[model samples]
Every structure is written in structure tokens, then in C-alpha cells.
Target: MGQDQDTLSVVALCQSERVLWMPDGSPHSPRFKDRYRSRSGGLAQAMTVFLAGAGLPVGWRGRNRFSVLETGFGLGLNFLCTWAAWEADPQRCERLQFASVEAFPVSAADLVRSARNAGPEDQPECSIALRLPVLAEQLAQVWQGLSPGIHQWRFAGGRVQLTLAVGEVQATLQDLDCQADAVYLDGFSPALNPQMWSAQTLHLVAQHCRPGATLATYTVARSVRERLRQLGFSVEKCPGLPPKRDRLQAVLRP
Candidate 1:
């Protein structure tokens, strides 16, 4: 932990962030020249690609505490959905920790708008969407405190925790000290945002994973799979949401 804190001391915070809105209500990143999340629906992508792929709800069930680490905190859709799921589940873990590293943090207004636009209307069956606005409001309330380095926020009467590392992905991941049970590899596509998926960055991610920790991502790019395998994760290509051919799911070998 001391080492991690030392790393955080030297890292820089995100700067000059902007999220562009499309006609269809999707958020696009002008810097990456790509959408913040899947056009099919951010909530849908979170459910199908990240939650289901990581065996969430079930994976976190019966555990005293579960942690999820994410590569990008774009709009925080994944975090909101996970928090809602934990709230609704009777068998949820007593504590949930979501840690994410972001080089660019969007404004509080953009976070709220992105979340409001990506709600139950996008996927009516998603119960999380029903409570999204309330949850997002809670998030926005504390969003202003977000600066560079590490900021921790507690919600759900302190049972849910968010540890946000606002800096470059590789450096931020190295500074994060948590044994994550699941991982969400979310960001722009590798072609557009290579730093988030680079071997060194992924290796830093692996260093924070407990044995048998699971990981999921919307991209099943061959290079990603190969790199993960070389790092000791059993990677597989899974069926993806509409307009996406496949997604990647991996588990660290014991």
C-alpha cells in the first residue's frame, strides 16, 4: 500500500475533458474518435459484455466483499449498473468495491446526461435502469471532488465504495492496490486507444488480480487474447451484443 501511495503522488490528473453527444443520445470521445460505449446501448453492453461475461451477481454472491477493477471510467455506466445490481440482490456481498483508472474524466453534467440517456428506455428489462437517475444523482453530488490521483467515495450507507484513479491508465493501474475479483476492460477500441490495452498496462492490471479472477471486454481482438494468454489468463471469445461480432472473457489460472 505504501508503494501504491508513492506511485499516486507523482501521477497527474485528467485534463481538458469533453464528451460529445450524438443525435441518437450516445456519448462520443473526440479525443479517441470513438464512442464511449456500444451504440446498441451502454446499459446493454454493461450487462451482456461485462456483467454476464464476468459472471457477476452470481460471482459476487456469498462473498463478504467483492471488488471489480475497470480500465476506463467513461461515464461510469458500468459502476452505476453494478451498484444497482448489488442493491437489488438479496444475496449480494456485504461490501462492493469498484476501482477504475481513467486518464480523462468527464464533467459531472456529462456523467449525469450520459447515464440518464443510457437507461431503462434503452433496455426496458434492466431493473438497474429504473433506478439509474437516482443513483446518478448521488454520483453527481460527489463528482465535483474528483481530481487527479486517487479519490474514494462511499455509498449505500458505506457498503458500496468507489476508488477512482484519475491519471494515465498504466501509471494509475500500477498505483491501485486491490485484489479484484472481476475486471472490466472498457475503453475505446484498441486501434483507437492503444494505451488502455497495451501489454504493460494489462500486466499491471493482472498484478492486482487475485487467483482465478475473471475479466471481460467488448473486444475479442486476436492480439488482446494472445497477450492475455501469455500473461497466464485463459481467454475465450464469447457471443457479443448486436452489431458486435464477439467479446473476450478470461480467467486467471491458479
Candidate 2:
């Protein structure tokens, strides 16, 4: 679609979700009744569950560019963590692209609050919190312009790029046309947010996966695993972060 047409089509905003800060400081979605990130903390979950599970840093090392597609943007913790990782790595890729879809975008204030609350105390090994506040501020500056369509932002001297599609899961995935090197399947639990884990939605996601692209998620739901398998991904269960038994990882087959 043309840029103007696409922008006009997305002018109608999806109602933003009400984000409630849990007693423990984690952000929770009232609509889904689910935590945005694990209680293990945003940075830790992004690293261990999404980055490590997808063999990031290592997978992207020496490459000219690396791109990741995420199902849910949430407070953008995953994007921040990934950007931090790329900046910290000595042999990082020349460019990092993070594309995500959020049906209900949260407010900029909530984004800042979420990062501040996700501190070292929540996950001691998570040093990314040190840079989160600044990164969050940068994201918040552009958050206000976000509409229902695709919004793009550049950071770190244009080394990092974030493309966010604000709309329904399936439609956004279908609208995106980029080859993903890694995919982070994060939203609510399958039982609570089934649309994000549905076979049809996953198939749309798979359409953007390049050969051998890796995928990871905090949930090891049988239905999710089966859907990935049917989509030609070699799915496997891996040891999860604290308080969680297992997480799912997979690689698209050539």
C-alpha cells in the first residue's frame, strides 16, 4: 500500500491497554491479566529467554546487519535490552533492526516507569538497567507519534532501528515485509492471549522468517510448539528463567 494510504488506514488507534504496576514492580496488562515480562525482570527475561535462546550476540556477530521480529512490544523492554546488547558487544553487527507489533500501545510515562521499576534489584545480573532510563527516555520522546500503523525510529547514530506496527497481531504480521533473523514470541499466556499464539497468526509470522532464523518464547505450550513445527521450525524446549520451568526455542528450516 502507498505510504499515505497506509498511514490513513492506521489513523484509527486501537485503545491503549491499562498497565498496572504490580506490587513487585512488574508491569501487568489489565486486559490480558498477564505480566508484560517475567517477574525475573525485563532485562533478564529479554537476555535469557529471547536473546540467548535465539543465540543472539553470537548469531549476529560478524554479520553486516541483524533483524528481530517480536510479537508484542509491551513496554519495549526487549528492544531496549537488544539495543544495549548490541552496543556492548565489541563485534556487534553494523546495524540492528527490531520490528514489533503491539495491539494496544502503552503510554510513554508507563514506558519510563516500567524501565525504572525493572532495576538490578529485580534481577541482579541485569546490568542493562543502568542504561535503560536513558534509552527509555529516547523511546518515550517518539512514543507520542505512534499511531495504528507502522512507526519507525533510529537510535545510536542510526546503528539501531525499531519498527513498530501498532495493530492486531495477525494483521500487523501480514503487513510487515522483512526477513527476520530472530523472532521473539512474547505476549500473554496462550490461555489468556490465544490470538497471539494461534496457528494462523504464527503462520503469518513464519512468512517473515529467513532460512534458519531462530525463534524463542517464554512459554512452552504444546499448541504453540506444534504450530511452529507445522510451520517448518525445529522446535525445542529449553530450561527457562527462575520461577519458570521451560521456554520454547526453534529454528526455521531451509
Q: Please give the RMSD to the true structure for each candidate, in Å.
A: 4.3, 4.2
Model 2 poorest ten-residue lDDT run: 1-10
Candidate 1 per-residue lDDT, tens place, 135-219, comes to 9989999987456779999999999999998877877787888899999999789988777788998899899999999999999
TM-score of each: 0.93, 0.92
Candidate 2 lDDT over residue span 1-254, tens digit each:
35235334544644455799878788887767888988878778988999999998899999999999999998988898898888889999999999999877888999888878776674555557777878999999988856677889899999999999988788788888779999999978999888789899999999999999999999999999999999999999999998999998999999
For candidate 2, list the clashing residue pairs, or say none.
Answer: none
- lDDT, model 2: 0.87
Error of 1 at 179 (Å): 0.7
* CA displacement after TM-score superposition, residue 185 of candidate 1 (Å): 0.3
